[model samples]
Target chain A: MSDAAGDPRVMLRCERLSVRRGRREVVHDVSAELRAGEIIALLGPNGAGKSTLLDALAGALPAAQGRIERRGRVAVALQSPDLARRTVLANVVLALAWWGVPRGNRAPRAREALRAIGAEHLAARPAATLSGGERRRVHLARAIAVRPDILLLDEPFAGLDAEVRASLLEDALSALRSATRATLVVVHDRAEAWALADRLLILIDGRLVATGPPRELLEQPPSLEVAHFLGFDGRLDDGLEVVLTRPAHVALDPAGPVHGRVTRAIPLEDGVRLELELEHGRLYTVAPLPAPGPGDDVRVRLEGGVRFPRFEASAPVPSTAP
Target chain B: MRLIWDELGKALPMIFHGNPQLLDVIWFTVQVAVVATAAATLIGLPIGLALALGRFRGRNLLRALANASLALPPVLVGVFLFILFSPAAPLGFLHLIWTRRVVFIAQTILALPFVVALSAAAIQALAPGLLAQARLLGAGRLQVSMLALREARIGVIAALIAALGTSLAEVAAVALLGGNIYGYDQTLASATLYEVGGGYYADAVAIGIVLIVLILILMCGLGVLQQQGNGIRMRFRSAA
Candidate 1:
C-alpha cells in the first residue's frame, strides 16, 4: 500500500478521533484514512458534525481522544474565507510568503494560481469588494498555491452560482486527479457528492455509518437511514424488501407496477421532475420528457431496484389485545 | 474669543517661522510622541495579540491588569519612574533623570495600557471566522498575529492616533521628570505651562493654539488613513 503508484503516502489517518466545542462533544469517536489522489466527500445533514470533522482534519480543532497521524502539510479553504483589506493578488502572495517562497518568484506563482481559477483579471481589485463567489475562488487559489499534501475544503461551493460552482468543482477535481495528494470535501447535498466524489463517507450524529464508492452507496445503501439520506424510500413487502432510489433513476413505462397521476411536474434544466400521487402519498420521479403537464396519468418502473431488511421503528405500539 | 483669535493668528506664523527655538520645541514634541507611540505599540501589540489569541490560565487576570493600568495618572507614573531612576534609586546610576529620554519613557509607560487595551479589543472584536480561516490557511502563530493585525489595521491606527495624541498633550509626566529645561526637554505643552506660569498669557494661548492645530491635523490624517483602509473614497471635483 505504501509503494503504490500515484500514492505519496497516507496523508492523514485518524484513529478514534473526538472533538468537543465548549462543553458539548460535537464529534464522537471517529476514524478514517485519506489517501493520495482521491477526492473523498463527507456527506451528512445539518448539525451532523460534518464541519467539526473537517475542522479536525484541518487541525483547527484538537482531538480530545485518540490519535491523528498526518504525514505531510495540510492546507484548508474554510467555509468563510477571510479576505484581508488588500488586493486579491496580495492575498495570494501572502499565502505564498507564508510558505517561505522567495519574494522574486512569488508574483508569478500567485498569478498562475489565480489564472488556474479564472480569477486573474480580478487580481488588482480589492478582495473585500469582490462577490462571494469570487472571494471563494481567490481563497481556493491561495490554498492550491501552497501545494499541500492534503487539501481540506469546507463548503467551498456553497455560495457559488451554478457555472462558477461547476468550474471550481472541475478545477478542484483536476487538481486532485493530477497531484499525488489527497482532498477531503464536506458537503451536505447528496447530488453534489455524487457528482464530484471518487469515494463517499456518510457521517450521522458524529459516527461514520457508511463508506464506499459513490455508486455503491447510492445503489444499495447500508441502512434505511443511509437510503433516506440519499433521497430514497426503502419499504418492506412481507419477507422481500425494496428500495426506491432517486427520481432520476426511475423511468416511465406504459405498463408498470407503480401507477399514479402526475400531481406536479417541475421542469429542471436537464430533465422534468414529476410528483406521482401513488398509494403512499406522492413519489417523485425524474425523466427527460418534454414538459409533462400536471394531472397526466404516468406509470413508473424502477430500473435498478435494491432489496434490504425491514426497517425497525424506534417507537413502540400501544397494546390493544383483548 | 478675542484672545483666542489673536493667539491663533500669532501661533500660525510662529509655527511657520524659521526660528530654531520654536522649531526645536515642535520637533521635541513630535519626537517624544513618536517614540512613545512606537515603544508602546511594540510592547502592546504583541501582548495584545497574545492575550486575544492565546488560551491559557490567568488570561483574564492579565487582561484586567492591562485595563487597570489605563486609569493610571500621568503624574503618579512620573513620580514612580522618577523615584526608580533618581540619583539615589537602584537604577539611578544610569543617570537618566531630567532628560527628554526620561519624558519619553514616562509617556511610553503612560500610553502602554491604552494601546494594549484597545488593540486587544480590536483583535477580539474581529469575526471569529476570520481567525479560524487564518489557521486553516496554514498560518502559524506569527502569521496569525500578522493576519489579525492586517485585518484590524483600521482600529489599530485609531488606537495609535489616540495614544500619540494623549502622549503629545501630556504635561505632568514630562514636566515633573523633564524639569521643563529649555531646548532640552521642553515640549509644546510644557512650554505653554511655563509661559503661563511666567505671566506670558498671550504666549501661552499662542502655544495652545499650535498644539490644537497639530492635534487637528493628526486626527484628520488618521481619519483619511482609516477611510483608505476601509476602501472608502474621498469626494472631490475635477477640473474638466
Candidate 2:
C-alpha cells in the first residue's frame, strides 16, 4: 500500500471530515485516504460510527465539517439495501439502466455480474422471494456490476450463520480480487478484517484511534482501548506498566508472575474457556478439556504483551497513539 | 312486489335489446368519466409525489389540506361551480355552464383530492432509504422519482380506481353543471335521476344496472394490474 503523501493512486481523500446526525456529531474530524487496488477494512464496535461514516463517505449524508474529494464514480451496497419488487435480473438491470447503460448491453452486463458472484441461477427469481444470504449476494452483484472506481460495503457479512458466512466470504473475496478498484468494507470481527483487508482502521466512540497494515497493527495495537478492541482478552498490570495480552499469548506455568483464581469453566466444542479473576481485573483464556474448574487458583506467564504507561482507566484516550 | 318484478323484467330486455337512448347515456357517461379521471391522474400524481418525497416548509400543511378535502361533498362542489359558471358570475364569459365540459371540470375537481391523498400515502409507505439507495446506484433525480412511483404502483393504481369510481358515479355535480341535455351532456347518472323522477321505473333500473356494471369492469381491470405488480404472494396450506 502506498502512503497518503502525494500518492497519485489515491481514489478517495477525506480531510478533517466530521458528520452530524440531528444535534450530535457522530463522526469526528478524521482524515483518511483510499488508494487504488487496496481493500481497507474499517473495524469498530456497535455504534462506533462505522455505518455513519460510510454514509458520509458515500455522500448519502452531508458532512457537517471537512472536505471529501473523489476522483471517480462511487458505488455503495448499504447494510440494508432496498430491492425493488422485480426479478433478480431485472433488479440488476434497472440499476444499470438508471445509470444510463445502453438498453442492448444492460441484460448481458447484469447477467455477467450475477455470474461473477455465483448468483446467476437466481436470475429469474423474484427479488422479494430471495433468502437473506441470497439478498446479500444480489446486493453485492449490483455494486460490482457498476464497475466503479470506489466501492463501499457496509457490513456485508452481517447476520449470517457461520457456514454461510464462510461461503459468502470466499465468493466476496474472489469477486473483489478480480478488480483493482479501491474498496472499503465496514466490519466488526477482527478475524474478518485481517482476512480481507490489506490495512485495518480501528474506530472507537466516533474517533479513529488506530490504522496500519493488518499484521503490523495486530502485533502492536498502540493503546489499551485499541488492544481490547483487537481481542486482547487478558490484561496484567504490574506496578510499572499495564500489559495487554491475547488468550493465545499467555501460557500456564508454575513460576509465572500473574496468579488468578478460576471463577467459571465454560465448555467449548474443542476446549474449555476459563474465566479467571485477578487482583486488578478479570481475564479469560481457553484451555484443553478437563482443565481447571471453578475455585481453582492458577499462575500464568505472559509471552510478550503490548505495554502502556500506567494511567487511570477513566482517563481520556488520545485519537491516535504518539 | 308484482310491479317491482314487472319493472325488473322490462329492465332486462331494455338492457339486452340495445335501447338507443340507454346506449347513448352509457357512452356519454363513459366519455366524461374517462376524461375526468385521466385529467385528475395526470395533475394529481406529481403533486402527490412531491408531497411524499420533497422536504420543504408548509408541506405538511398542504398535505393536511388535501386529506381534509377527501371528504369534500360533491353537492357543495356542484353548487360552487354552478355559481362560478353562472352568467352573472366572474367566469360567466367562458360560457361553459350547461355543457359536458363543465361536468368534466367538476368531476375532475371532485376526484383530484382523492388521487393526491391516496397516491401520496402509497409513496410514503415504501421502505426508508429506498430513494437514497437508488441515488447512490447512479439514478438521477427524475429516475429516482420514477423508481419511487414504480415501487408504489399498487397503491397508485388503487388511488386511480378510487378517482374513477368517484367520477363514474357522480350525480349531483353532473346534474347541477350539465343540466341533463339529451344528446349533449346527459350521463347515465343524471339520466337515471331523470327517469326515476318521471316515474320511468324500468328505464331508471336499467341505467343504474349499467352504471354498476361499468364500475365493476373498470375496477376488475385495475385489480388485475395490481395483482400482476405484486412479486410476493401468500399461500395457505392445511396440515392434513
Candidate 3:
C-alpha cells in the first residue's frame, strides 16, 4: 500500500491480484510491490498461495481479477530445473539466445553466468543428470543470464544441502544487491528467510497477513496465528499468560522469571537447544549453557520477551513438582 | 517353401547386382517418403507448435481433429486424393492423377496428421516448468515454442520416424492416386501388386523382400539418429 516512489522504482506492482482454480480462489486480493534492489521473501505454509502468487507474477497464469504492473522484464526460476536436455552451458546459452544476445558472444556470456552460480564445472554435464541442487543452480544461472529487472524464485533451496543452499543464497542475494533488480524468494524456513530477506510477507490462506522487516515480523508477530506460524505456543498460568517462541529463541538462566528442569538437550551447530519443562507441565525450547541433562533441576527465564495474550485455557495445568 | 526360396534367391542377386529396376523402386520409395516427411514436417511442426502453445478457443477441437486424421486409412486418403485429382473431380483440371507427384501429395497428407499429432504430443509432454523458465528468461512466444521443441527433440525425432515409417509402408494411397504407371508411379508396393496380378509371383516376392529390407534399414537409421541426438542433448545439458 506504500507509494512506488517511496521505495525503489516499483519493478513489479500487484494490486488486488486474485487467482482462481476451478471456482476456488487460490490467491485472494493479494497486493505487494517489488522494488528494485530489494529482496522480498514470501513465506507461508504449504498450499498457502506462495507458489501461486509467484506464478501470477511471472504471468504463467492469468489473474482472476486485479492488475499487475511491471515496469520492465521479469525473470523466474522455478523450483524445478526445467532446463532442456542440453548441456549446462547450452542451457545458459539458450537462455541468452532467447534474450536476443547475439550468437557469437553468447557462449562466453553463458559461461560467465554459469560461473557466477558456481556451476561452471557442470557446464558439460547433462542437466537431467545433475543433482537437484546442481539443476537449481543452473536454473538460477539461466535466469540471471537474462539480467532480468525482477527475479522470482520459488523455493530455490528446497532440496539443496546446507552448504550448497548457503552458497546459492549468497550468490543470489549478492547478485540482486549489485544489480538494479528486485527479487522475490519463496521459502518455508524462517532462518533462511531471515538471512536472505530485506522484507518479509506472510500469506495465510491466500491472504497477505503481515509485511515488514524480517526482525519486526519475528519479534512482534502480528497475531496469534502469526505467532503459531513462527513456531510458538501460548500457555496460561497463575492468572498470567506466557508465549514461548521456538526453542532457538529462548535462553535459560538460574535466576530467570521461569524456572524448570531440562528434559532434553539437542546439540546444534552453534549452540545446544534445551527442551525444559517449567513448573506446571509447561514446555519451552531455549538455548542454555551447561545444559542440565534430562531430570536435572534447572532454572529458566524469558529474555527479550513480550506479553503473550492467552487465547484459550480449558485444560488443567499439570504439576511441575518432581 | 521352394517358391519362397526361389524368390529370395532371385531378389538377393538383383539387389546385390544393383539392378536398375530394383534400384529404381528402392530409390522411389526413399524419395517419396523423404519428400512426404519433409512436407509433413513443414506443415506439422508449425501446426503442432501452434496447437500446443496457443491459448485460443477450440484448441482441443483442433487437437482432436489432428488425432482423428492420424487414424485415416491410407486407402481412404488415397481415394480422397484420387477423387480430387481425377479428371472429373473439382481439382481435376491440374491433371495430376497417376503421377509420382500425385503419390507424393497423397502420402504427405497421410503423413501430415501423424506428424502433427505426435509432434504436438511431444511438445505438450515438455514440463510446464520448462516453459515457465523460458518465459522468465525473456523468451517470447516464438522463443518458448522453439525451446519446447528443442527440449522435446528426441520425441520429435521419434514422431518423425513414426510418420516416415507410416508413409514408407503405405501402398493403397500411392496405388490409387499414382495410377502405378511404369517407371513413374510403379513403386515397390505397386510393382509387387502388378507382378502378382500378372502371375510373376517370384518378382512380386522379390519386391516384398526389398520393401522389408528398406524399411528395416530406415528403422536402423532412425535408431542411430535418436541415439546420437540423445547423446548430444545429454552432453549439452551436463555442460550447463
Candidate 4:
C-alpha cells in the first residue's frame, strides 16, 4: 500500500537483488522497498526463494547480483533462533553486544527488552530450556533489543499452534506498530497475509510475479499464478476465465444465474458453507440461508466473482531473469 | 602378593623422602607434556575449526589425513622425528637433536591429531543454523566464532584432556629423540623404561603407578566435562 521507494522514510531497499546457491541462482531480480511502519508479507510456496531473499536482506547471505541499501541497522529472527548454551538474559545481551552496545548498558537494556516481551521470568533460564513459543519470543526480544531500523523474520510463526500463532502475530505486529521499524516477514498462508500485510510480494520459483497492496491484489491479481496462490480457483473459459469467490463472499438468491445441488454443508459461526455441485465443477461457497440438505437445489449470488479476459495462463510461468 | 608389596615398599622411600633424580624426571615429563599439549591446542584449534566449518575442496582429505595420523604407531613417529633431527637431515641445521626440545617436538606430534580430530568433531556437533542466525543477529566473525566455541566448550576441553593424556604417556618418541638422558631430558615414561632395562623393576613399577594416577586424573576431567556437556544437551532437547 505504501509505495514510497524514494522517500526519506525508506528503511531498506533491494534493487534487483539476485541470490545464488552454489552456481545456480535462487532469487532473481527482486526489487522492493521497505519504508518506516510498513509491513511487507513475502508469500510464496516452498522453494520459492523466500528464505534466500530474507537472508540476503538481513545480510546473512551475499547477493550474487544487484544491491541492497539500508539506512540503518537491520536485525532478523530466523526460523531457528540458533540459541547458544547460555541463559535467556545472556542470549539477548549477546545480541546487543554484537551490535556494539556498551558493556555497562548491555544487561540493563537486554533485561528491559525481555520485560517488554513479557519474558522477564525467563531471564535466568537456559535458552535451550525454553519451549518453541518461548524461544521465539526470546528471539523477538533479541531482535528488537538492538533497536534496528529494518526487521526481517523467516517464517517467524511457523510450527506454532493456532493460539500461539495468533498471539505471536499480534505481538510482532504491535512491536512494529510501536516503532518505526519496517518489517518483512516470509509467510506461506496467503489469506492471513492478505488481511494483515500493508503490502505483499508474491514470488514463484524465485521470480517476482506480483507486488501490491494485499487488499488490492486480493481483489485483482495481475497474474494467474498469484490468483491461484491466493486460493482463487477458476474454470478454464475460452477467452475469459470465471473466478470462484470464497465461501464468505457467496450469498443465496433465487434470481441468481449459478444453480447447484448441495452435496455437503458446514455451519459457520455466522453463516453456512455449502459444497455445491455446479455444472462446470464443484464450488465451495457460503450463504446465510437456512441449512440446505445434501440434495437441496440452491441458487447462489456471486458477490465477489471476477473475470480475467486480458491474461491467459495457458503457458508455464516464465522466469524473470533478465 | 609378597612381591607386589615388596615392590611398593622398596619404591615408597624414594617417593616420600624426596628423590631429586626421580622428581627431576617427573617434572621434566610433566613440563614437556604440558608445553606440547598447550602448543597442540593453540595450533590445532584453528585447523579443527577450518576443517569443520570451511566449505571447499580437499576438506575431507585433510580430515582423512588427520584420522590416519591417529593410527600411526608412536615408534614410527619417533623414528620419523629422530631422522628429521639427525645430523644428515636438513632440520639438523638447528642442532636440536637429543635435547628436551626434540622431546617436545615428538610429544606435540604424537598429541596433535587427537586435538584436531576431536575438536573438529566437537565443532561439527554444534546445533545447525547457528552461524547463519548469528550473522543475521549482526554478530561479527570473531563474535560468531566465540559463540560456536562456547557451545562446543565441553567437547574442546575433552579434546585437550585426551591430547594431554596421550602426550603424558609417551615414551617411544621421547626416548628416540631425547635419548632418555638422566637428569637432562628424561621423563617419567622414559625413566620407567630406564629402570626396567637396568633391572630396577620396583622403581619402574612405582613410576608406572604414577603414570596410571595421571591417567586417572584425566579420566576424572573427562567425567566432569561429560556431565557438563550432557546438561546442555538435555536443555537443548527440552527446548526442541
Candidate 5:
C-alpha cells in the first residue's frame, strides 16, 4: 500500500496548518505531505473538519497559521457539484480555460476527460438538465480536464445509491489516477478508503489522530476512538486481558475460551447478529444463523484483535495569528 | 364623448400612414432607449454582482441605496440633471444642455437603478457554492465573475428588459434635459406632452398611440428572445 506513497516526488507539503471559520479554528496544527502518484483518503466523523481541511489545502480558504508549498496547480471537485448553466462539454472546457489551457486544446482535453469518466455521451447536454449522478461525473471531468498537480475531492460519492456509487467509484478513480500528481479524497465509508486509498489519514475532533495504511491501522488502532470508528463494537475485559471486539473478528466455536450468553439473535441477510452478555460487558457480533437464540450459551473465538489504550482527545489550540 | 371619438378618428390615419413628425419622434425615443439600456447593462452588471457576492463593510448600505433608488421620481432626477447642466453650473463648460447627448445621459441615469437592483437580486438567488466552485476550478476574480454572470443569465436578461422599459417610458427627464426641441431631440413621450400642453388633442392622441404600439412591438420582440432561451433550457430538462 505504501508503494505509491514511497515515491520521492513531493507534490504538496503543508506545515502546522490551522484554519479558522469566523472565530472558531476548525483545523488545528495539521502537518502532512502529498507525494506524487499517491491517493490519501481523509476519514472522519461528521463535523470533524474534513471539508475545511480540504478547502485550505486547495487554497480556497486562507490559512490562519501555516505555510503550504505546492509544486503545481490544484483542482477540486466540490461536494455540491456547482455547475454553470452551459453544456456539459462547455463546463469542463471552462475549467480547462481557467487553468490556462489553450483554446485549441480545451475542447479535446475536456472531451477526453469526460470519456475517462464515462460521461462522453453527455457532452452536448445542458448542465442544468443533468441528473445527480450525471452531475457528479461532469464535475469529476471538470476537475480532471486540467491535469492538476494536486486534486481534492470533497465527498465526491456522497448522496449516491450503492450501484451508482460502485460504478462511479471505479470510473472516477481510474480517471483521477491518470490526471493528478497526488489526490486527497474525503470519504465516510471504510470500504471505500480500503478500495481506493493507498493510505488513510484519520481526523478526530479537528486533530489528525492517525495516519497509516488502512489494514495496518485497522489491525492496531492506537487509540480507543480510532478503534470505535473502525467498527470495533465494544471492549471485552475478562479480568485477564483487554481485547477490542469487532463483528468480523468474532466467531462461534464450542472449543473457544471466551464465554457469553446470547441476549438477542437478530437475523440478517448474510448472517445472524447476536447480542452477547459477557462477564465484563455486553458485546455485539455477527454469528452463523440457526445456532444462537435468546438465553442460549455461546463460546466465540476471537482473531486478530488489539488492545487500545484509553487516551484523552486533544483540545484545540488557540490560534496565534495576528 | 363626441370630441374624443372625433380626435380618435383624426389620429387613426396619422398613426396608420406614419406621420413624418411622429415617425421622427419614435425613432429618437427608440435610439435613446436602446443606447441607455445597453450602457446601463454594461455599467450595472459588475456592480450588481459585487453587491451580491462581496463581503466587505458597508455592503448592506450600498444594497439598500440601490433598492431605495428604484422609487426615485423621474422628474426629480430631471431637475437635478438640469441644475448640473445649467450654464452657471460646474458641468456647464461642456455645453451639453438641450442636446441628444443630455437625453441619453438622463435616460441612462434613470434606468441604471433598475438594472443594478434587479441584477443583484438575480445573482443572490443562485446557489451560494457556485462562486466558490469557480474559484476552486482555478478561476481568477474576473473569470469567476464571468462564470457567475453566465450562471445567472436569466435574471440578467430580465434586468435588461426592466431597464429598457424604464428608459422607454421616460418623458419628464427627456423633456427637461433635451428641451423637447421640435425637429432635433423630441421623443414620442415628450412630443405627446408638448402636443397636449398646446391643446392639439388629435396630434397628442396620435403620438400617444404610436408610443404604446412601439413599446408593445419592442417588448414582444424581447419577450420572444427571453422565452426562446427559457424554451431551450426546458427542452433539455424534459428530454432528460
Candidate 6:
C-alpha cells in the first residue's frame, strides 16, 4: 500500500479497535491512522462495517476493544443531513454555538462557512425546505464552518445530480488541498475515491483488505478480493482475471487477443464507450475511432504486463454478515 | 333540540349576569387543566424521551406499557389514586384526599399516558441523525436532550394539547377524587354533573355552555401553537 499514510502527523489513530452493535461486533480489530492534511476514502461492500468504523471513530459508537485517540475536534457530515427544525442559518449557527463559539460570533462565522461552500443563498431558507443536493451543501457548510481538525463524511454525495456530484467533488478536493485537516470519506466506487482521496482503504467483512493511494491500490491491488472489488472482470492472456487500471487501458484492436460481442456503444468526447456482455457479467470498454458499433464483434484487450498483487491478513478472519 | 333551546333560554341570563359561582367553577377547571398538564409534562416528557432513545432489556416492554396506558380508564385511575390517598392507605401522609390536590393527582395520572406515548412517538419520528449530529458538535448529554426536545416541539405541542384536552374534559376522575365540593374542588365538568344530578337544569346548561366556550378558546390557542410549532413540519411536507 502507498504508505498507510504519506505524511504522518497522525491526527486520529485507532489501534486494534473493535466496535459492537448490540452483542455482535461489526468492526473487529481494525487499526488505522488518519494524518493531518490527508484525504482517505474508505470503500467496502454493503454491511462491510465501514459505517461502524466511522461511527466508532466519531465517538458516537462505543469501541468494545482497543483504543482510539482523537487529537482534535471532529466534524461529521452524517449520511443523512439531519438539520434542526430551524432556519438554514440557525442550523449552521447551532453547530457553532454548541461548540462554544461565542453567540455574537456564530452567525457571521456560519455565513462565512456557507459562503465558503458557495451556499450563502441558502442561509435564509428553512432547512427542511431544501432538496437533496441543497441539504448536502447546507450540511457540508455546517461541517466546514466549524473548521474542524478532523472531518468524517459518510456518503456525502449519495443523492445528487451528476453535475452536482462532480462540482461537490471538485469543491471537496479543493478544500482538502487548501486545508490542513485530516478527512476520511466513504464513497461508492474506486473512480470517486481516485478523484478526491490521497489514499484508499478497502474493508471487507470488518477486516482491512488493502490500503494505499487510490491509483496505486487499483494498479496493484493487494488482494484478489480487492481486485474483484476494483471491478476486474477481465481475463488476461494467461487466463487470470485482472482489472483494467484505467479507461486508457482499453482499446479496440482488430488483432486484439480478447474477444466479446458489443452490447452498447455510446459516443463521448474522447471516443465511444462500448458495453460488452462477457460470460461472467458486463464489461465496459472504451474504443477510439474505427470503434465497433452495437452488434459488432470486437477484440478488446487490457494493456500488457498487468500483475495480480496479493494482500494477506495477519491472521485469517472468518467473515460474517446478516 | 327543544330541550337545548329551552335550557339555553333560561341559562343565557345567568351567563350574561356573570354568576360568580359559575366563573369560579370555570377558573377552577382552567387551573386543574393547566396544573395537570404541567405536572404531566414534567413527569412524562423525560420518561417518553428516555423510552424512545434508551437501549435496555425492558425498554420495549416499558414503551408498550406507556402506550397501553393511554387506553386506561380515567375513572379506574381515579379509583386507584383514591385508595392510595385515602386516610388508611400507605400514601395518606400528604392528606390530599377529597381536595383539589387529589383531583390534581388523578388528572395528572390520566394525562400522563397520552403525554408519554405521543412524546415518545414524536421523538422517534425525528431524523435519526439529529442526536448524533448534536453530540458530534460538542453538545453534552443535557444539550442533546434539550436540542432534541426543541426539534420535537411540534410533536410535544400536539402531546400537550391531547393531555390538556383529557385533563380539561374528564369528570369522573375529579368527581371521584375531589368529591365535587362547592367553592373548593368543584370544576366545570364536576359542577355540571352535580347540577344535572340535583335537577338544576338551567345551571347545568350554563356550565355546559361555558365548558364548550372554554374548549373552543383553548383549541384556538392550541391551533396557533400547532401552526407556529409545525413550521418545520409544514416545510418538510411541502418540499416532499
Best by TM-score: 2
Better of 1 and 4 by DockQ: 4
Task: Between candidates 1 and 6, name the one with more favorable DockQ.
Answer: 6
- Candidate 3 lDDT, tens digit per residue, A1-322? 2234433588888989999876889999998888888899999999999998998888878899998878667788888877787678888898887777888988898888888878889999878788877888888888777887888989888877888888887776665564488899999888778888999999999999889998877677666667678766533244455454545445565676666777777876665666677665455664535556777777655544334445542221222211
* Per-residue C-alpha lDDT of model 6 across residues A26-50, encoded as one tens digit per residue: 8889888898888999999889998
lDDT of 6 by residue, B1-240 (tens): 998899889999999999998888888899989999999999999898898877779999999999999999988888898898889999999899888788888888899999999999988888889788877878776677777677787888889999999988999988888898888898888899999999999999999899989988997898787887776333321110
Which ranges of candidate 1 are over 4 A from the true structure?
A1-9, A102-105, A233-243, A249-254, A258-282, A286-305, A311-322, B1-23, B64-71, B79-99, B125-137, B179-184, B217-240
Judged by whole-model lDDT over C-alpha atoms, candidate 2 comes out at: 0.84
Clashing pairs in 2: none
Model 4 over residues A1-322: C-alpha lDDT tens digits? Answer: 1223467889888888899987989999989888888889999999999998998887778999888888777888888767777789988888887888888998999998887777889999988789988888888888878888888878877777878877777766666554488888888877558645799999999998888998777677666667677776533232344454555456667887778789987888877777888786666776675678789998876666445543555332322101
Q: Candidate 6 lDDT (Cα, whole model)?
A: 0.80
Q: Residue B145 deviation, candidate 5, in Å?
A: 2.4
Q: lDDT per residue, candidate 5, A1-322, as tens digits?
A: 0122233577777778899888999999998888888899999999999999998888878899977777777888889987877789988888887788888998999999999999999999988899888999998888888888888999888898988889999997788774337999999888788888888999888889888989888876767678788887856763434566677777778988778899988998878898888887667888765667999998877764665332332221111111
Which regions in candidate 2 have their CA more than 4 angstroms from the true location?
Answer: A1-6, A253-257, A312-322, B1-3, B231-240
Of 1 and 3, the candidate ahead on lDDT is 3
In candidate 6, the residue pairs with backbone N, CA or C atoms under 3 Å apart (3 or more residues apart, or in different chains) clash, namely: A222-A311
Predictions in order: chain A TM-score? 0.85, 0.91, 0.85, 0.84, 0.89, 0.82
Q: Model 2 over residues B1-240: C-alpha lDDT tens digits?
A: 999899989899999999887888888888888888899999999999999988899999999999999999999999999999999999999999998789989999998998899999999999866677778888887787787788888898899999999988888998888897766788888888988988999988988999999999988987987776665432211010
Q: What is the lDDT, from 0 to 100, of the residue B24 in candidate 2?
A: 83
**Cα DockQ of the candidate 6 complex:** 0.46
Give the range where candidate 5 chain B is weakest over 10 consecutive residues by summed lDDT. B231-240
lDDT string for model 3 (B1-240, tens) is: 987888777767766677788788889988988999999999999999999888899999999999898888888888778777889889999999877788888888888988899999988988888887776676788778777777777888888898888878888888888877777777787788888888887778888888888888988888887788777533323111
The most accurate candidate by lDDT is: 2
Instruction: Give each model a TM-score.
Output: 0.82, 0.91, 0.87, 0.87, 0.90, 0.88
Between prediction 3 and prediction 5, the one with superior DockQ is 3
Please give me the total number of clashing residue pairs in predicted model 2: 0
> In model 3, where do residues sit more than 4 Å from their true spots?
A1-8, A234-242, A249-281, A286-299, A311-322, B16-19, B233-240
Give the TM-score comparing model 3 with the true structure, all chains together. Answer: 0.87
